[model samples]
Target: MRKGDTILFETPPAIAEFAAVGGKRESEGPLAARFDLLFEENTLGQETWEQSESQLQRHCLDLALQKANLAAAQLDLILAGDLENQCTASAYTLREVDVPFAGLYGACSTMAEALGLAACLAAAGFVGHAAAMTSSHFCAAERQFRTPLVYGGKRAPTAQWTATAAGCCILAGKGQGPFVKSVTFGRVRDYEIKDINNMGAAMAPAAAETILRHCADTKRTPGDFDAVFTGDLGIVGTRLLKEILEKEGLKLDNHQDCGLLLYDIDTQDVQAGGSGAGCSASVLCAHVLPALRAGKLKKVLFLSTGALMSQITFLQGESIPGVAHLVELASEKEGQA
Candidate 1:
């Protein structure tokens, strides 16, 4: 094996299920209650995304490393990124953990990008072991990028819910673990969907294009893989994905292969879907891990999709740009390791 070659995703407690455990009754306010449902435990009642992101990464990384039985120094490389512009959240939080690292930002698709780079390095014998981590916070992201929740403003139907959480994965050189067979990168598309009210509309094209590329580059059909998932395109983005993919002669099954809409909290009432980098990371950490561990899922594709356009960019008359990253996660084949 090479430096950053083999990748393994550590299974962790599901965010929704974990949030639901010893579940508390729904609280007041749709947005507030929505956050409470997803991150109440990790949040400790923080009202802002900045606060939540800071706290969650610190705790989540510890749990992830523990589950993997990995020490900070054991990893030769730590590649991290997130939805936050400067990525200081992961920077500051990761400081508590001792490791050499680099900060990255691909919006929602950050984890995939980091993994993709890690895999290339490993495959090329650049490094032996690497860890990729990314996270998001609803309060911090919304206030800085969108409208502050304190104003009690009404969000449009297209608005996606920002999730508060974190996710981390360890990639080994070539030692008995899930192998990252390949990674497919997508082109950026600016769709002019600047409403900020409809991020799903903005990010759907990116997801569709990337998924199409993955199938094309790998010479595999949608049916070839057990699942083809997207980051946080939400309900509307998923709808757009179905339509767009069909145009390109590709189709995705939401029930089986997609990861667009995972937040089902009753209070959020977000008609479109979930948003933010954490939306995908949290769901992958929760649902995908357990399914793989149970031996119920064999091969799965994870596409972390993101809308690159920021609130200020939209206000500045720039269109909402999008990008999607594809990662293949599969357990070892019979006796291959």
Candidate 2:
């Protein structure tokens, strides 16, 4: 059923299993222990950084399936994406799996977008089992979107580190707990910020807009959720988002950004924090889902924000447009009632 801008799932899809994989730097972060697998090297024994990113997605999917006690043949569909040209990372990752695949490109918001779509399909009986995954590699993103590592470019203070990470979640029509209750797809919003280095500022307005819309659509307030998570907004974008929300009469007290939670910004030299498609993906799988399953969090909102800009667009001096997607998750106890 649809309510305002939100799609309320009549039968909430359960996150049957999930996995998180991260690179060396992420393994050094505060949430390191939460990740299922960590690679000491960015390459993961692959010939190229892009190939390594593919491996990250592949490994995450494999792990999630293993945890669910399901095979690739049992999966009805796989929705995946990445921060690569043509979404090659996800395509190559599933090439040998022999499953129906759909590629998505929501920039950094790919995870939430993929998960929301998968949940909708699952609830509608279109698929019994589906996988949603996304990945990003620091080296590959640097080579594609900015200067190559060899350039030794000086990053701005507001610049964020693109994480070398991946996450996968397998949703089933019926399962144990941690259900996806609803979803809100965000609209594109451009703030006319041209600096490619400061993605947090470029994406903050959209985050605010989406949060406000979701709240109004559901007739809920910040107090209704145990927590609100914004994907990869970093330090700068997070502060801006709060300010924007405050001005709109919404004061969020239990808010956290996956960017900030993924790393120890002060000592990590990550400038603002982490930012990438994989940043929130890995964090959601590693930390948030577990909390929901354990009943530590009764209800929560996961919002993934993205800067919808390409290298070509940035080079052409096009202003960055941002988007955010929201998914409502609840524990089994709450979902059942």
For lDDT, the strongest prediction is 2
Give the Å error, residue 240, model 1.
0.9
lDDT, candidate 1, 185-241, per-residue tens: 668987778767777788888877777766665566677777777787777777888
Worst 10 residues of 1 by lDDT: 13-22
lDDT of 2 by residue, 224-307 (tens): 889999998898998999999999999989999999999999889899999999999999999999999998998999999999
Q: Model 2 misses residue 110 by how many Å?
A: 0.4
Q: What is the lDDT of residue 83 in candidate 2?
A: 94
Please list the residue runs of candidate 1 whose C-alpha ends up more than 4 Å from where it truly belongs after superposition.
1-49, 254-261, 265-268, 333-337
- lDDT score, residue 176, model 2? 89
